[model samples]
Target: MTLKVGTILEGTVVNITNFGAFVDVEGKTGLVHISEVADTYVKDIRQHLKEKDKVKVKIIAIDEQGKISLSIRQAMPKSSRPVEIDWQGERNKNSGLSFEERLAKFLKESEERIQDLKHREGRRYGTASRR
Candidate 1:
């Protein structure tokens, strides 16, 4: 099969390293970088992939040197992917508030958070100075 960018293919994990995993797809080996292994952060590649594990990978890039870059996260079907929450849309849905009102509320909450943080920092330094 011709490997093109955006092509999703099933592959076997031939090897795993600290940086990424080598996958064999249709007789060609591709590198699935650690960041491309999952939608969430992967602290250790071994936690997500193991040698001989079958994985579906999307062809993200093909370098001039013929190196293929694959992504397991992108290969996943959209139905199985996490739905992105629109914070503003959700807030407006329930509150029925205008944009200006939302903006004012957000500013108030932000200022309150900043003041709370400043108070906590002051307390920490105040106690530390006495030691």
Candidate 2:
């Protein structure tokens, strides 16, 4: 069966290489690039997947060369999804900070960043780099 983008299909890892892995989805074949295999940094693909491993893959692209780019990252379940957001953390009006206070805080942060850059430049070029 032909796979389209955003289509999630159950696949079997048929082969593994340093670059990526080939998956067989029913009669069709799809390839999940090493980068698309996981959300976290993957130094080695072997550590995450093995041959004959069943994986759910979302078709991300289909090139003119008939390459099926798949994403296992989107197919996999998120282990820790944030259930509730703490409204106290929000910087909006609900945070009890007035708009003017928020603007002043923003200006303070901007000034701090500018001062930090100036300090870094002074240290790097002995205070003569600005000229």
Candidate 3:
């Protein structure tokens, strides 16, 4: 079968590697990179899949060498996904704190953390060497 981008297909996991999983798709083997295995971070690919596992994957790219890139996450329906938090949006929602107030607070906290780190380094190594 001719593979095309965005086409969803059923494939059997033929091999597993540290970087990704190889799937046999209708006689054509494609790679589903670990990062493409899920919508979130995957520390270990084995945790999410196993050899011979039947999985649904979406065709993401096809290179000149016929190396097919697939994504299992894209094939999954969006409704089942976890809510992704936007840190910037959350900070903006704090309407009570002005930009200047936030900046000042950040600077003060950063200074305190830096001092603490320096103290820890000095204790651990008899003093941190100056660059």
Candidate 4:
């Protein structure tokens, strides 16, 4: 029943402000910061939330004075979560290239790409005069 940081709870919206919304969750209360309300820009808090509205919020901060700050952003559905990019195509787990070596390889590849684009078909480096 005690509110704790990182705890997720269902709450009712008691008030809505330009900055954020206030919710009372599990007999405890907290404020959902404006920046933490949603993933996209919110020009008006009322557009997305309203008084007496039900929402799920995640407790993010609990001050020594028991002040609780919450985030509805953290409770966003997984479908709206950030997509993690896999770099496995760049290197395997056992690749031994050092940082400097990898940088050098990257530079070499970039230079080749630029050269390829700059030159016309079959007019590559050292082959300008040839057919």
Rank ordering of all candidates by lDDT, starting from the highest:
1, 3, 2, 4
- Which ten residues in a row are the worst by lDDT in model 3? 88-97
RMSD of each: 5.7, 7.0, 6.9, 5.3
Off by over 4 Å in 1: 86-131
- In candidate 4, residue 70 scores what lDDT? 94
> What would the TM-scores of all predictions be?
0.69, 0.65, 0.63, 0.68
Global local distance difference test of model 3 = 0.93
**Model 2 clash pairs?**
none
Model 4 per-residue lDDT tens digits across residues 11-118 = 999988888998999877789989998888888888899899999999999888888899999987788887877899558752788889888988999999987776
Q: For residues 38-122, could you state the per-residue lDDT of candidate 3 as single tens digits?
A: 9889999999999999999999999999999999999998887877778988777666888898889889999999999988889
Give the Cα error of residue 101 in candidate 2, in Å.
2.8
**lDDT (10s digit) by residue, model 2, range 1-131:** 55788888999999999999999987778889999998888889999999999998999999999878889988866564235676756746446778788889989999999999988988888874554
Write out the backbone clash pairs for model 1. Answer: none
Model 1 Cα lDDT, one tens digit per residue, 15-128: 999999999999999999999999899999998999999999999999999999999999999988999788988766748778788899889999999988887897888842
Error of 1 at 106 (Å): 6.1
